[model samples]
Target: MPPHAPRRRARTRRSIARLRSASIDAFAIWRRRLLFLVGGICVGLAAVFMAKLADAAQAAFRQILAISPLLALVVTPAGFGVAALLARTVFPNSQGSGIPQVIAARHTHDPALRHALISLRVAFGKIVVMALGLASGAAAGREGPTVQVGAAIMAAFGRLTPQRLPGLILAGGAAGVAAAFNTPLAGIVFGIEELGRTYEARTTGLIVAAIVAAGLTSLWLVGNYTYFGTTDAGLALGGSWLLVLVLGFAGGLAGGLFSRIVILFGRGLPGRAGAWIGRRPVAFAMLCGLGVALCGLASDGASYGTGYEEARAILHGDAAARLDFAPLKFAATVLSSISGIPGGLFAPSLAVGAGLGAALRDLFAEVPIGALVLIGMVSYLTGVLQAPITSFVIVTEMTQDHAMMIPLMIAALVADAASKLVCRGGLYHVLAEQILARADAPAEPVRRTA
Candidate 1:
């Protein structure tokens, strides 16, 4: 061949190599973006489904209650018992607030454990059992289950990419919070405070993108409404600050007691009681359901479901809730939680806080009921979660009230401190430890049925 021909051939080879490189680069970029887009879409769709399910469950419960209070009484125990049985038989590793499972998936080293904790089956079970709990008049929320659904969706999508499991879990969880509450900032804060526990530079963009996408999806469907609706009320900053202090301590004590009870029950009942409960979990769940039913009857149905309507009503200056709402809702929530069903405490906790604020309304006649409701929400949530920033931001975002930021922050801080005094660790973290312990144990063949 001629020398010129050889040089031409070399140039052609070089050009083809460059073209191939560019094509690969473009493909990689598209794949990465596609993964994110799909993940976000899944998270958003899951959030919307969770929201609808929650609403439907509550509506069903209300219909039953209206038809006959006695029917509700019969339904609650049967519903809880059947749900507990289904959770044991059909959906292993799908019980309690789903946040713990996500946390376990994020932290565990074993791949099998992570998969067991957060998977498509578990996500489906979480939604089904949570709805069942709500339909039965068991106090529960969809927000927690949404987190698991989001995490499972994102994690499953992440399998298509080179993303790490922890980042995928974190991003999905944050997206769940954002979409569920329609509070994107709070979702990011939740990622930092509860999910990640420390900001990671690598996952920041992913988390933000997922949150924005999921939040927008929720807004598109729900019309940009706040979780608790808007409030124009603000405090005068003088003696009103005293109201914040009082509310902080009161809400803290109540929230701390709640945390302590839940943690103790989660760890296991003491001695013979624990053994008995372990053996007859369904029966125990039925008894707990009875307690919830009684609480609901006592509160005239205020203690049933997620407590969202009652809390929202109080925030809007409606006096429909009774004075004993706080205690009744608290009882219902604790009982429902200990029954080992798939549900969340977010809504019920906020409701308990709102009821506490309403109860204190007699003392703070001059303060706006809306403001007090917001304070109690932040304070109690902080107490339960022990994440002051997340609690405050969630309350602020849900209320759409920037004016109460300072008071809300103060209440959260105070409540966090008080909660620490009662409970050694946050609820989710403590429960996560249990999952970790189970992961560390030797693997056993998981029975498909109870």
Candidate 2:
């Protein structure tokens, strides 16, 4: 061999050796991470199961009070106050949907950490707030807080441990929702498609596991009922398909309007009354309580809670003066929602869409109310979340009716498109913007080390 060839071969060998060493180091680090993740998943799933039990307890408590909504409404503020204080004191990062927190955490581009408060206190606070909010006629749902509760439980179990990557967090998040709502596949889909923002093979497995774990937890406690008791009235075929198209169009328009109005109020109220309310949360909550109480008295306690009864009424085609009540329910719900009382918009949104759908179905007099209600659900959900596929899937899953798939797809697509045209952000995104904007406000500079 030439002298130069021998020298080049030696150089190549050293380079290859260096590469091999680097690869080995990377693998070692990855293995440790993998091990930690497996441990976190075990810990997180356990926590999720426990939280589901707590949530079940809360649900039972709410049901007991639901028998006397007026009196129950009064008790909600106390719950909210305690929850708010705990949340502020303990898991401040856990405030709101907490979807944003996990989303932010997943982004390597973002630099932040969970404090001791977020893992324990925040989750508890959310539970208290959510329960109280539900009791008090807050036009919100429990899913968001429950999701946080699950995440917090996971974080607590895995504390002092190296951070799991975004995938684990996403898995935990999915499990949280699955456990809360008793919808495992939806939870899996939500984790992979909605929250995780990917459907890769690896992510699908982790999320599916988490969802299964969560669903098992929920089924053990809550029984396997869908959140809404949607009727299985078959979808209209042939001539009725036209009605579905009409419902889809109508739902899209209504959903778009609802989305716009929420944004308008959420933004307009701010810069004016929000600061005042912030200064006097107790007073604002009291006023809200009174307003909700008065609404109950006016409607003879009809316009309260998550609108479950109203939804049933719509489903049965037994609604009387529902059109008039729709506006009131919408107003009450929107105000309660914007007031920052801990609740979920999911149920309220569903209720709103149902009311609208029922009204339209009555007007048409040809289409089945069930079909319209389902369309309305997809419409409003698509508009709010701007996730037509998720919305449609959730509605279909909730109702367990495959016949309306075509109509749902049509309505969802239109509603999402319309919402996008009118609004710059989806429901959670708008909320997230407010949250991050609040968080990202320039912190007072600390003195630098020399």
Candidate 3:
């Protein structure tokens, strides 16, 4: 062969190598994007399904109540028992609101914990059990479970690209919040404030993209509907300042007490009583359900399900929920949560806040009821989650009440501060710690994978 011919062949080989490298790079980019898109779509579809299921559950419960309130006494306890049995027997690690499980998975170093916490099996169990709980007059929300479901779906996708697990989990959780509430901004804030707990420059784009994709999908399916509908009510900045202060303090105290009770129960009911309950979780769940049923009876069924309707009515000033709604709903929520059933506190907490506002409205007749309800929601939710920005933004987006932004922000911040004074830690964080502790136990059985 000629020397010139050899050099030409070398050049051709180099060119082919470069072309091959370029093609690989392009394919990698496309694959990553596709993964993200698929994850977002999955989360969005799950959110829509969760929303519809919640609505149907509430409707069914309402119909049952209309037919016979007595039926709830039997149905609620039986449902809770059945759900508890399923959780223990079929879907271990799928109990309670799913936010804590997500938090535990994200914070833990153990791969098994992540697997146990966020899996397709757990996701399926969460959806089915939460729907059953709501249908049986349990005071629960689908939003928290959606967060876990979203995380599970994304994590399952992440198994395909092992390097992207953390970012994908974060994005999935944020996307779930976005789709659940139809509040993209709140989703972004929740990712930073609650899930990530710090802003990461690398993951910001991925998180935003996921949230937008999921949110857009939800908007397409459900339309751009405000969660609590529109309210023309506006607060007078001068006079409403005191109203904000009252709500902030009151809501903070109430929410803090709630967290304290839940934490106490979670830490195990204090001595033999706790040990007894631990041994008989199914029976305990039934008792808890009875408490919820009694509360529902007290509220005339107003405190059942997610309490979404009452909250919406209060926000729109179309109905005045009974003053007892706050306490009754609060009790029902606490009982349901401690019962080991799959459900969320987001909607019920908002309803509790609305009930508080309704009760307080009688005292502050000068302020618009809608405005007070909005403020109370921000305060109480902030208190529970200790995420002021997320709480205020969620309430604002849900109500489409930009006019009360300043008041809402102020209430949320104050509530967060007061809640810290009482509870010392946010609800989800405390619960996550419990999950981590359990996962670290030597005898804790590794969840079986499908």
Candidate 4:
């Protein structure tokens, strides 16, 4: 061979060797990553199972209470006390709504802070506490605790895997919401809009898979039924379009105020009276339960448990027996939420909005009640979550009302914008800030020195 030809052949061989080495390295890295990914999937599925089981348990328990509202009020609160103790001691970070904790977990860089597991303790604690809150007429929903429980299960498995665990945890959290509420599409939307922060194809797939699995699991166990009974949800259209727009604007304002009040009242120290109440949660819960029971006595137990039943009654153009109990419901929910007793704001928020909407429907007989309630649902949820698309899809799907699409979309946008104007941070962000502050307060010296 010529000298030049020999040199060229040697260089080609060297180049080929380098390429092969690089390919092997890439394969090794991918193989490891694939193993981690599989681990995440397993973690996610386990989370789905736990979340579904918890949801089923809570629903069954609540159904039993539904048969006797007063007993539910008393018994549930006592259970809440036990759950609260477990949560406060075991996974304090998991207390209250899971959304804030999840946000903190995702945003915080400290692995230790993020290392907190979504364990069985947190799950069962939240479930019992939320049940108690609901039983005692706490103005809260079960979805929040279920989400925490779901994330805890996911986190357990996520801890076994690599850094990609947060994504899996988020997917599982969303699935829990879907399973608990039996709103799969909403769960997917919530994962993207609220938890994922920014959507990517991989995250989307994980969330979608988790939601589909959990939703199917829940449906298989519980059968299909909207939390609230089905409604007409059709828009009257024509002249009333303007009215709907106005309502949307108003609803947005209401939602913003509601969120603000919750964060403010929840965080600010309430002086001696507040301290006294906080100190005696059990007694306070009992008193509140009694108060709710007394007020509910008038209407033969009309306002109770997530407010869906009453909202349904209102949508049907029938007066709720305890129409006057809306205020009581609001008060109980606010207290339970502020007490950090493991519950969600969404159900209470929806109930409050629906109640207001139903009242408006009564006041304005010309508009469709279903449309009003749908608008209210979106308006309130968007205002608080600041996730217009998620809120919109959730309510729209719940009603399956294509005709009200325009109004629902419009309402969601207006409410989101208006709520933003009032508070730059959404409700979850506000709560997360408070949680972080509380977590960091004691470590301030260490952080400052560092």
Candidate 5:
């Protein structure tokens, strides 16, 4: 027998163990990546599903209007009432824009609480209720609700593995924005500026990977296209720049007021009025629906649905947007939002901005209408979300207009300041806090259904 035989066998055993350890580690890493990739693809598909649903709903509602413009008074209120009832009873956490619920889920430590906020059930309810609202001609957007749905899907996937990654929810949300708008860069910016509030190096890969996957999926289905189309509008630093200042400040203040009203309603109205709304939320939702119907009448059906077509036309200089469309759209969006129906504010806000810009286009006839429209968009969006970078990036990506970046950035800054003057808190963050408070104080006489 050779003495070296024992040492050789030991070395072989060590090599085998090392290979096994490396294989296990590699498998785990690959599994996590696969989850993220699959989750991202799912999010993209969900975005497409949601967009198609919203489009079909709006088309159906338009047909109803063709039959009789006044029919919305009945259809809208009745539909809003049902949506509110379902949100209250069957989907307690599926009310409003759904962005708030995602934000709340991110902040919460309790797994159960987060589950309640961004669960599969809540995601399904969000889709159904949001579609119903759109079908009823409610002035709302689907983009925001898409964020919640994406987050829920990603969170559910996260639970499949023993090692839970906290940023999966955030990544999912960012991916949703990417797929919904086909704007990958804006998704990254939103994930950093709006959702996570800070850059996480570890999750950056996950975020980018998810965004790319989702964007590819959406592009494959919907084809490559900009949200607002291409524009050659530029803002030189001269007399035309003054429009930026004027429109920026005005849009910001208006956007700020919108956010303030929403927050106030979310906290419930003051005293007896609040109590009354609390007791009969479904009825109040119906009232709000009626208000939206009136806005629709005033706008000649322009204020219904997501306001996407209206905004797109105005941006492209194809439509003579009504002078009062901005304010009416604003009122309708606020009413739909406070009614506690499931819908998003992004498209309606842009519609209001487009109308506002069109209204001011006469005053600045020398300025390019596209420039004013672009400025109005950045200003108002920045004001609503209090996320300047996200707002500018999204508008830039949507319009595919790099020439307006400088003015848009400046406008966003101005809007951010003006918005803070009216409403100190960001809309989603404030709503998220209220959600947390309600969850913590469940015994309190808080109206979750509303």
Candidate 6:
């Protein structure tokens, strides 16, 4: 009724509209947050599922060994062949450790191409084939494959909204690492050091949220436990630290040689040999499986599967096979990597590092066996990944060994330098480049069958 009534009414209308708009914006923001949380939980469940299956598969293989160790000669080869065939035909992108595929997926700008690399289908195949490789006695790990699957799952969530999908991919991978190892800090470090190579402020919340969710999920399912049992041994600055230098150099050299060999095969062998292998990939995989079977025989089955049990035994100073376990495990991992089957190097690499450390017990009698094993693990892992921060962080987290942090860092630096001397690039990045190149290449025309 008053002259100012219309103006007041208009102001109230504007206020209500603003409130509605704010509510909508808030809902959208929380929606994406919820999606990320749920996705991370899913990633953790997937990691646990894959891990259980891997353990079961390894157990099954051990049973076969009990029945007759010679059975691996037939079983491993056939398993390798089947895995390779499935990867090549049914799950084209689900090959190798899957980390390289995640890396490649992150770099590509094409949404469709990225989707293809990290699709759910590819994740499914990775789980199945990776298990098959382990069940057949291939020396491999499940961690790297978990990374790919996690990334794919997170990317799927990202698709539901117009959020930063690439960042989601990176976060998924970090979550995978966290859930798989139950090491949240290591996951963030790996995201920065290996996955992203630099920090993104906007993605920080996403990474933390995903990691917390996934880490909590994993803890809930499996309960708290260190990847390797806790070691109270400390490394002093004087004589004890000398072992760090020795193991650093040795582990780095060995690790670099491994990366070089795997890369060489990835690039294809020279001349006719390369062509022959290319033409008969399944057969080559069989040969590689046979090589792994021999390694297992030599190591008294210690070199088979992920080598986790053997590594743990040596690290804790318990009884384990000691017949050049490190070298044979190394050889088996290299073969599994290049055999066109789905598997990971994380567990196997740690197993090799543990073996290497235990073998040098005579050189550093004063150093606790645990200290030596820790150094060797950090050194070799950094050497292979060429990620000093990630290598040391993950190892430190796995063992909860703050006493050896300084020693581990120094060893990581040494190993990185030594690794670069033999290997020009980090393993995952190099393989990622190869993957991108292959993806960009024009697809071969399908041959018509009459």
The global C-alpha lDDT for each of the candidates, from Candidate 1 onward, is 0.86, 0.61, 0.87, 0.64, 0.90, 0.88
Ranking by lDDT: 5, 6, 3, 1, 4, 2
Q: Identify the candidate with maximal TM-score.
A: 5
| Pairs clashing within candidate 3 | none
Which lDDT tens digits does candidate 4 get at residues 91-115? 4665667777766666665666665
Q: Is candidate 2 or candidate 3 better by TM-score?
A: 3
Error of 6 at 316 (Å): 0.5
lDDT of 2 by residue, 1-450 (tens): 677998999999999999999998898656545543553344345444544544564466457556775564566455445545544554465444566555444432333444332355666666666665655555566666666556655555444445444455666666766665556666766665555556556555555655665666556555678766656765656676665556556656655666566656445456658788667655666666566555655565556666765776776667743565555666666656545456655566777778777777646667778887888778876776677777787777777778878888888887777767666566665554444455663322211101
Best by lDDT: 5
lDDT over C-alpha atoms for residue 347 of model 5: 86
Q: Which window of 10 residues has the lowest lDDT sum in candidate 1?
A: 441-450
lDDT of 3 by residue, 58-137 (tens): 89988888889988999999999999888878888788888888878887778887888999999999998888888888
lDDT of 6 at 398: 90
Which should have the higher TM-score, number 2 or number 5? 5
* Stretches > 4 Å off in candidate 1: 1-26, 162-165, 441-450
TM-score of each: 0.93, 0.76, 0.94, 0.78, 0.96, 0.95
lDDT of predicted model 3: 0.87
Winner of 1 and 4 under TM-score: 1
- Give per-residue CA lDDT, model 1, range 219-331, as digits (tens): 88878888888898799969878988888987887888898998898889899999999999999999999999999889888899888988999999876557889999999
Better of 4 and 5 by TM-score: 5
Whole-model lDDT, candidate 5? 0.90
Q: Candidate 4 clashing pairs?
A: 73-135, 76-132, 118-152, 138-333, 139-332, 139-333
Could you tally the backbone clashes for each prediction?
A: 0, 2, 0, 6, 0, 0
Where does candidate 4 stray beyond 4 Å?
A: 1-80, 135-137, 219-232, 274-295, 316-325, 421-424, 441-450
